[model samples]
Target: MAFVIEKPTLKDIAQMRALVSDEVKRGVILERSEEEMANAIRSYHIVRDGGEIVGFCALYVYSSSLGELRSLIVKESHRGRGIASALIESIKIEARDLGLEEVLVLTYRERLFQKLGFVIIDKTLLPNHKIWADCIKCKHFPICDEIALIAKI
Candidate 1:
């Protein structure tokens, strides 16, 4: 099957929220709301196969030179086909275009991200105020098992 990556639109918010919630329930990503997803829709990139969304990722810019990749998810049936990789690449390109020096994520898929050039990082060097703010509400906060990683843009 052929795949393409594109910026998600408002029309895709509900589908995106569904896909994301599925991943969260499966422990692949964090839970989120349609409002939050819609608010960030312009920063979200989705991977489509046969014109249906199969995967997605978002870049939330924290500073002029920094961004955090949030809520990356691939459909269960479509995993292992590089759809997630395409979504990530789309975010990386956006970071580059935005002149960001680095992008980071709190992810369970450390190996997958490492393969894509992200390296593990200590939370201290990251923007704690920004991440910690949202993380405070997370069920996994403080004791989050997710690995923190960053890739230079």
Candidate 2:
């Protein structure tokens, strides 16, 4: 099957929320409320197989020079079909369009990001703003076990 990666619309919010919720339950990604998804809808890119949203990812810009790749999830049935890589590539283009210098991610899938040109970095090297704005709210917080990776855009 072919997949298209493109910006999501308001109508896509519910399906996007459902996808994230499934990953959240599996402890693979963070949970996001519908309102949160709606507010950041412009930041998201989704993979559609016909009319169904099978995968999605978001680029959360922190500053003109930095953005974080977040909430990347490909349905289990759709894994290994290059959807995730395509989504990341789409985000890289968006980051460049916004004049961002780099993109970062906190992930357990370090090898996957590495293949996409991201290098492992010490989590502490991340900005205090990121920590204060989002990390603090994460259940893991100061004890986060996710690996940090960065890629130049």
Candidate 3:
């Protein structure tokens, strides 16, 4: 099936929220309340596989200089189908359009991200709260064990 990627509408928030939160529960991504996702619908994107919302990603821009790739996930059945990679490229395009100099991710998928052009980095080098804002909510916060990775956009 051809997967179509685009920004999520307010109407798409509920299903999108379920997919994202499910990923969090699986430890593939971080937790986000549906309320929070609803509040930031414009920042999220969904990949429709012939009308099924099988994948989604979000780019939370901090400024012209930086952005964070948050809540990236693909339906489990669709894993290895390039679904996540496509969603990631979509976010990179968004960052480039905003003239962001850098985009970062806090993830355990080190090899996967590295193949996508992300480089491991000292978490300390991230922009202030760039890690903290979300990390603080993470159960692993303050003692976050996720690896920090960045890809200069």
Among these predictions, the greatest TM-score belongs to: 2
Tens digits of per-residue lDDT for model 3, 29-87: 77777788887888887888776688887888887798889887787888998888888
- Residue pairs with backbone atoms closer than 3 Å in model 1 (clashes): none
Predicted model with the maximum lDDT: 2
lDDT by residue (tens digit), candidate 2, 23-66: 67765687878898899999999998889999999999988799
Model 1 per-residue lDDT at 133: 70
Model 1 misplaced regions, further than 4 Å: 26-28
* Model 1 alpha-carbon miss at residue 10, Å: 1.0
| Model 2 error, position 142 (Å) | 2.7
- Better TM-score candidate (2, 3): 2
- Stretches > 4 Å off in candidate 3: 26-28
Clashes of 1: 0
For each candidate, give its TM-score against the true structure: 0.91, 0.94, 0.90
Model 1 lDDT, full chain set: 0.83
